[model samples]
Target chain A: MSKTILIVGGGLAGTIVANGICRQMGAELRSGALNITMLGTSETHMYQPGLLYIPFGRMREAELFRDQRKVLDKRVNFFVDPAKAIDVEKNQVTTEAGRTFKYDYMVLATGSRIMPQTIPGMKEGGHWFYDLDGARKLRTALNEFKGGKIVINVNAPHKCPVAPLEVAFMLHDYLKAKGLWDKAELTYTYPIGRLHALEPVAHWAKPEFEKLGIKYETFFNTESVDPQAKTIKSMEGSELPYDLLITIPPHQGAQVIDDSGLGKGGWVPTNTKTLHREGSANVFVVGDTTNIPISKAGSTAHFEADVTIDNLVSLCQENTFAREYDGKVFCFVETGLGSGTYVWFNYTTPPNPGPPSQMIHWFKLAYNRLYWLSARGLL
Target chain B: MAERQKIDARGAFCPGPLMELIAALKLASIGDEVDVWSSDKGSASDIPAWCAKVGHSVVEASEHDGYWSVVVRKAK
Candidate 1:
């Protein structure tokens, strides 16, 4: 009998794992020795890195979306439904639509969700560039701005650790292009003590931030935002006034993981090296859903997929996972004006970012195209 | 000189130039050439790579004045 492997979440990690496994186990899949099914909430897959280009008008919204069906391989079964709960004891999952799936093995790649409402007045008062709608709104607001204090504030545990810095750098270029650089005061505030979570990246970015005249405020735990007053207060009672506010809101794992009691603090706990869920033998987790103590960026998902697929193949064959994930992460940080930097690191090595250059920027752009091919297991 | 269509994708980011070349190739007749002018450094190599994958032919790829111009012909 064929063993069923059900994957939850069809985002970058889920799709990549599905396609990777299908390609590697083609004969098994064709011979009905292995069965695969992917469950997702929607048919649309958004190329999230394109969200970074929206504020700069470098990419259009239409270019960022593709049919998820087109991206997944034909050998993998896909369902458009949200997973509701996981019964780890029974090796089964239930969906919101009352459908239940039994599996021999399961993979969770549900990613993360942004909670803007967690902060007072944030939804109405501030804008973000992480989502398509927010980016479009910010683009319009940025285009219509005359000149004043522009603040980029970040809440903790957000996705894409370098996004706030990228926004700051791009905003500087945007203002300079409009001849309003001197008229606008750019400030970036983070809950962390350093400008970046990664020390090496912070070191390289400090001088660049100085050159762009962007003020960095660290240890800024957000207390609340007074949208009417156009000011944000830190937990320490300090206040910063702003004419425009762009916020990276708090992020949490999917509610299903929490509801199923598979997660604590809204995140699934998995072995950093083994990529297996804590206390679950046949369950594996990847992407932002797992509390992996790394930047919750797409590159992290891409790298984790490699380890997960390798281990999953071993599990299907030998009833044991054989591979260990190194926690390798690669990120392309856009510094604006057709230039960017590359950050590469793993569990053992800290990030050693190279100087910003146009070539890295182009590589990042090329990645957007290659990502689709990658989703189809073609690249 | 053979008739060639020019796509000025200069200053556009990666995949943008490649997408433009693909779109132009769709409109061109077999054997007609499309030239893409891109300031993005990746275009010089990416366009050729894409052409090779999809059965198109890259005729001439050259650099000039802060940008790259790549000429591709629709093979089929």
Candidate 2:
């Protein structure tokens, strides 16, 4: 009997898993003993991390996308139909196109999305760079601005932990280059008491903020944005007036996870080590879809995808797991226009960021191009 | 008999070399040495740390012109 593997979501995690398992399980696939299928929402796969450079005009928009079919292994039975519901007990997934897929083993990689509309009046007032449309709008806004008070507001559970900091640093450099630095007063606001969720990163950023004379307001949870009044109010009783408002909006997992009643807020409760859905031995959860308290960065998804690939192959071939995911995450942090540093940490070790340098920045640029290879599981 | 395998992972960045070493060790026999050559500075320490956590033994580690080579013996 042949074993069927169904993967939901064709993003980073799912793509890597689909490509990787195909690479390792070639004989099984050829002999008609294994089936791998992927369901996605689109034909184009966007490199989301490249969206950061879009607002700054540092990277071309075309450089951030690839044809999804060309990137995946030819053996995968791919579909552009998005998942509507996943019934774990039935071991089945239903798609928005009114089709059903039954699997021997399933992988849920349905990633998260930004929900700026959740914040009252924010969708109308604020500018964000998390998506392509938002980034293009922000580019025009930044390019046309003369200078004034600019507020960089951050919300929790957002992907790419260092992005807010990176944009702030890059914005400062941009203003300086345009001779608008002195005219512009940049203020950063975070809901937490520090600059970042990670303690070491907060400690590192404070001095850099001070050196650059960037003012910050800690504990400023957003209450509402009054576009008419040109002011934003916080739940902590702080009101900030701004000429330009840039925000990192809050995030939520895919709607299908909630519709299926698998877990609250679209995140499935997952076994941190084994990457399995809670109470379901045959179901796996990967990347941002798992309710694992960690950065929702691309590296997190890539690492988890690799683990899932290895385990799924082992289970199909040997009725066992190959290894466990060790909670590993690696991310590169851009400090300025020309310098960067990186952090690598697991469940046990805390990340220690080194001094930013031009070499690491170059490496980041190179990696940006190599992301296609990474998605294909060749890297 | 113990055997030696070499992997040239000189340009791979953080976690890249470590992941490659793990993949190689899985295919090697017990007491086999997998020498990982890495230009990433973090790997000299990271490879050994991973070995320690996963019950593998690092026989020797040394630095060359611009890279480091760490030899590990798969214990399991």
Best by DockQ: 2
- Stretches off by above 4 angstroms in model 2 are B1-76
Model 1 C-alpha lDDT per residue in residues A1-379, reported as the tens digit of each score: 8999899999999999999999889889989999999999899999888898887788888899899988888888999988998999989999999999999889999988877887788888889988888999999999889999988998766788788888888889888998999999998986644577666777787898898789978757566889999999875356899999999877778989889998744578788788888898788898888865566878888888888888888788777767788768888899886789988777656577888899998998899788898677566
- Top-scoring candidate (TM-score): 2
List model 1 lDDT by residue over B1-76, tens digit each. 4458776666432114665464355435798998888776867987787566557789999999999999998887
For model 1 the interface RMSD, in Å, equals 21.0
lDDT of 2 by residue, A1-379 (tens): 9999999999999999999999999999999999999999899999999999998899999999999999999999999999998999999999999999999999999998988897898899999999999999999999999999999998765788889999999898889989999999999997655687565777999999999989999766677899888799875578999999999987778999989998656778888789999899999999889866556889999999999999999999899889998888998998888999988888667678899999999999999999999999999
- Please report the candidate that would top lDDT against the real structure: 2
Alpha carbon lDDT at A135, candidate 1 = 92
Total clashes for model 1: 0
Q: Please give the fraction of native interface contacts (Cα pairs under 8 Å between A and B) kept by each candidate.
A: 0.00, 0.00
Model 1 CA deviation exceeding 4 Å by range: B1-76
